[model samples]
Target: MLSLRRILTVSATLGILLFLSFFLEQRLQAVAFRVVMLSGIAVVMAVSLNLINGFTGQFSIGHAGFQAVGAYAAAALTVYGHNRIFGNLPRSGQLPDTLQGFLLGAPAMICALLAGGLFAAVVGYVVGLPSLRLKGDYLAIVTLGFGEIIRVAVENTEAVGGPRGFTGNIREGIYIPNLTSFFWVYLMVVVVVVVSRNLRFSVQGLQYLSVREDEIAAQAMGVNTTRVKVNAFVLGAFFAGVAGALYAHFEQSVSPTSFGFVRSFDFVTMVVLGGLGSITGSVLAAVVLTALPEILRSSLGAEFNQYRLVAYALLLILLMLVRPQGIFGRGELRLDRLFGRKGGGGPAGRDNVEDQPAATELR
Candidate 1:
């Protein structure tokens, strides 16, 4: 059952945010809203990717591949569906009830997300089947190749506009009047974070950790390492797909280059910098990393834009020098730890003191 009190609390908070977003003429509101959206997306991407990279210790740089699949799948359904049903793409200004009903119904968005996730999972299975046999750098190379292949495939696919890209009306021209509001994005992010937290504490998540720890030993202990690893891979792909769908709709554009190796590196950098297995760390790092680049670009302008990359490079070097294990290392950062679950390994069931490989293990 939904908690009425919690719902009301959230609603009230969101109402305030919406007012600030709409009413305030200050540029700060725009920046804040963008930050919130970016943070939400980052949380989704980081947490889901964590399932494979952090919990399962998989070396998958194909994160963006799944995202691309989801983005196109969702964008195509809405854009094509509207054109087919209405005989023309709904323009932004106004729309008839037929299109409005179709677009405004939250159910369509949910369906699109499901389609995206399922498609990405299918791709995950196909990719994982061949690549899982490899190890370490070999696995990373295979996943990297997979990402490039996805980009190439997207670039050549005329249905989605190939390299030219695709853009059309989203929301069926309903002028839905603030459908992508703060509350919606915030709720999605919160749900994702909570679900990830619960999954990390579940039996399957423990199995993922077992695989990460030692595949041979995990297999000896009756864990189906292959299934466990694939579960992480597919599940992570699903969330990545979801995030991509959200981003596509938010930006109202779809491009193959948008979901390429550089995007994958951004995600990996967030996970590695935060603490591979630490959910809290991932969320924090994602928010910081995503915003930092934009902030630098804004403040420094084109003249200093290149320095932003240098800054990140220097930060990476410093992180390696100071603590190669990462800020959290194998340690998790859950509120539960402060209370009593310390060393319990919230989801993975490993001893907190156990030595685990560094994020460099993926590289």
Candidate 2:
């Protein structure tokens, strides 16, 4: 558990880091910038999904559906709003780099992102209501079906460019311009991680864990397992939606295919590959998986690129065989556990002396 002061310090430090990211983005190369932004989005998705699939032990495969909803919502709002507001003005990304641009561009984009999150949260509640009651493969089926349904619905909707997908170039403020994305992306990553961590330590979070450990036991103990499950889904989906918005804004376009069933599995892979119930592991896995393909293609050339996904699948298979609990297992990396290897026992913990009566008596 972190103390209030320590937590606040961490929050402030992250805020400072966000400020520094904007300051440093101007210096980072294009590829590096792209990686950072994409990694941030990955972190958002992986950590948020981990809350549902990892901590809550729910099998949700429709996360991409919520993301699509958010993506299209934000994109439509931005593309249309920008057109209606400024018509032919220069895009927000092209605005002055001075304080004025920061004030205007940052706030408008933040509102759009938050708006996207709000829309997703409402939809998450609706989807979670009926679906969270089920468990195991049934739940997965429901989520998968939900995702496909969203895709089909979007494809048929002529308002958002139909099957061709919604493509737009912003000529003014309404979306997050690519230029300021690193700041927004990493900031949200920090937010997701912090919220997940905090929730896991809260009373409600314990109920979530209890439900994961045993739903019947949790229910018997008076914990509302259904409530916990729905909360997990809604919270996780909100972050996923925010990730979608950031992604859509960065790419400056989105399609039904962008957030398909396969994309949902990519997130699941990140969570399962990372240690479930381990926030740090999720973040690390997100960064590695997000960057692995690019690294391979650049370093190993074109032929290897085609087999990259195969390599990823193989690596996951090997990890399951070798370390089924993932790189870190159920526990997390804590500062207290870093300095020394302490024996598992009482008060300050005792030395490991299973066969030494005298050693046990001494401590």
Instruction: Compose the digit string of candidate 2's lDDT tens values, residues 1-363.
Output: 999999999889767876776676678887777787888898999998999998878998878898888888877766676656434324543555554655556655675688678888898899899999999999999999989999999999987767987765423334335424566787888789889877776667777777787788777777778888999998998898898888887887789998897788878878888888778789988899888765666678999757766777898899999999888666566655687765455654222211111111110
Please report the candidate that would top TM-score against the real structure.
2
Per-candidate TM-score against the hidden true structure: 0.79, 0.84
CA displacement after TM-score superposition, residue 219 of candidate 1 (Å): 0.7
Error of 2 at 156 (Å): 1.7
Q: Give the local distance difference test score of model 1.
A: 0.71
Q: Which stretches of candidate 1 lie over 4 Å from their true place?
A: 1-28, 83-89, 93-105, 169-180, 303-305, 334-363
Winning model by lDDT: 2
Instruction: Predict model 2's lDDT versus the native.
Output: 0.77
Deviation (Å) of 53 in candidate 2: 0.5
Query: Runs in model 2 with CA error above 4 Å?
Result: 1-15, 83-93, 96-99, 169-180, 298-305, 339-363
TM-score of 2: 0.84
* Predictions in order: lDDT: 0.71, 0.77
The all-Cα superposition gives candidate 2 an RMSD in Å to the true structure of 6.4
